[model samples]
Target: MAVAKLLLLILGGVAQLYGQTPPNVRPPTEHLREQRGIERGLPFVKWCCFASGCFSRPPSSSHSRTLPHPHSLTISRTSSHLSSSPKPPRSPSLPPAFTIGILLCVFGGLIRAYCYRALGAHFTFELSIRPKQALVTHGVYGVIRHPSYTGAFGLGVGMILCVFDRRGVIMSLVASAVASGGGSDNDQAVVTATLTCVCVTLLCILYFGFTKRMNNEDAMLEKHFGEEWRAWAKRVPYWLVPGVY
Candidate 1:
């Protein structure tokens, strides 16, 4: 019950985040126009229509001219029929895994926010340092050399967890079989279970793999900060997680 409540809270937070608009950025009319543009640009609805065979090619000007009046009327009726048809049933729900994933994502988001706040003026999306950028060795930086990456890794793990289910497992195996071109589909449930275990193992491997990026960042910092960076590295040897990393 507590877990369920927590999940609902996380969902509410996510919904709020999705609905949030940038403060004082634009007039209401301009914002509405931008929102409309974004909605039109999104491929989700189009993909859904295509998948359900509801999508039809728009009538070209030439094609429309060639079509007789009666045929055009029939086309409109066909479109109406398509629209009136019942939608496919919803997929099976996997609430437990999804809720856990959302929790992890929320935690990760908090970590990212903390890191961003701590970095203040020094943070940049690019590898290049600002002219007056100081080496941030306090707060979140003191603990992790790349807290932002840590947050991103958390998000990745969360996303994987989100889809980690029987269906996901089966799909993964199917994908592997297709790629390899030499696998029987027998005992798929057992194969999928094994694949799920392997996926968890891979997630661990990927988490540790962030060390490669850490090394790259270290190199860049060494080039930029020289002795100061070396000193900071000595003080905070851990790239992420104090003892384990």
Candidate 2:
């Protein structure tokens, strides 16, 4: 029994020594082997083995410096560090032109709403055959037959106000003149001077031509509403510009 107890104690001591390493133990050489395996993109744990074919125990921490291969951790760190910056936010600066545009938009919206309300059931913003549609003489239509178009023209002026500077404003005015056949832009300011002359000439011509056609429209209305249209015509003779007819 004494011999058996001694044998048991010896076996226990040997088992303990083999199972647990010393507290001050250095990193195993297997770490180098593991690192090498990682450098070649191989599994460190699978390749880890003792010379006598015994498999090594895993490191205590997964994040330990003892990788299966030497440089596997390095490659991971580098790849992670090389990521690009994410997308940036947009600027909040409002340009002068944009500001004016917003105001013009608001004015246009208000005008449209007023016209719609004034016209009520007879109102149609589009060119549709509302043959029975009565002439709108109240609100905006009392002065201008096409108040919406007048508002649109005013809105154009409002848009020009949004220009960043006086140069922008002048350029815009010149562009408008060109569009209206008021004048062309020469290299000199002569074009701007001529713009007014051309615009006035064009306006007189349009007034005679277009206004005559519109007056003829009153004849058609006269045929429909007869004396009623005549009375309205006398009250609001001018179509676009108010009080000048």
Candidate 3:
């Protein structure tokens, strides 16, 4: 954990150093030549010299002014207009949902580790139980029959949120809209809503499938342990949740 924290701090420091301009640093100035060329309606050009010693030059200013060109291609210096135009409002910083997700992932991983440690000799990658394996009804196992599955589910949720889930998407859209100095458009709102629904549907599907698999595993355990498993099940009653399956 200390190593992880140190690594995170290092990465954050590096990102901060590289990602943002220093307060003391001034914005780059436009070159006088480029500004003059723009004002004279000349096409922007770069002088390139090859190893073979080939060179090229843009047309002279007089010839450039008389040449027919699309209006869209013309460069206009509208610095005053731009400066006067209403700037988009700075977006308010959002709660650190990604950090929360990372915490969840860490917590889930710890839970899984605890579960495995509690299982000890009985812990197996496969569903099959060893001949002398005893029922684990202490620690996390006491609370949930499938503690590993609970951890796995938590990990899945954490990963979803960490990457780009409904929460992240909504936060991004809200931030973008706020930065653009307006509320989301109807189309954008619709898309957001649709994506949210899809995310929910996918979560529900995963939950349903996981529960179905757990039920099958429970049946297999019951067959293996018979009355012992029945009594434990009666005591616990729930698989992943307390008082709720």
Give the candidate number with the greatest TM-score: 3
Per-residue lDDT of candidate 1, residues 99-200 (tens digit)? 665566566667766766776655433344556668888887887677776665655555555444322333444545543554444444456677688768
Q: Score residue 63 of candidate 2 by CA lDDT.
A: 18
Using all chains and alpha carbons, the TM-scores for the candidates as numbered come to 0.53, 0.36, 0.54
Stretches of model 1 off by over 4 angstroms after superposition: 1-96, 166-186, 194-205
Give the distance in Å from residue 102's predicted Cα in candidate 1 to where it truly belongs.
2.2
Model-by-model lDDT, in order? 0.52, 0.42, 0.49
Write down the RMSD of all candidates, one decimal each: 16.6, 39.5, 23.0
lDDT comparing candidate 1 with the true structure: 0.52
Give the poorly placed runs of model 2, Cα more than 4 Å off.
Answer: 1-105, 125-131, 160-220
- Report how far residue 72 has shifted in candidate 3, in Å: 24
Q: Deviation in angstroms for 90 in model 3?
A: 7.6
The TM-score that candidate 3 achieves is: 0.54
Could you tell which candidate, 1 or 2, scores higher by TM-score? 1
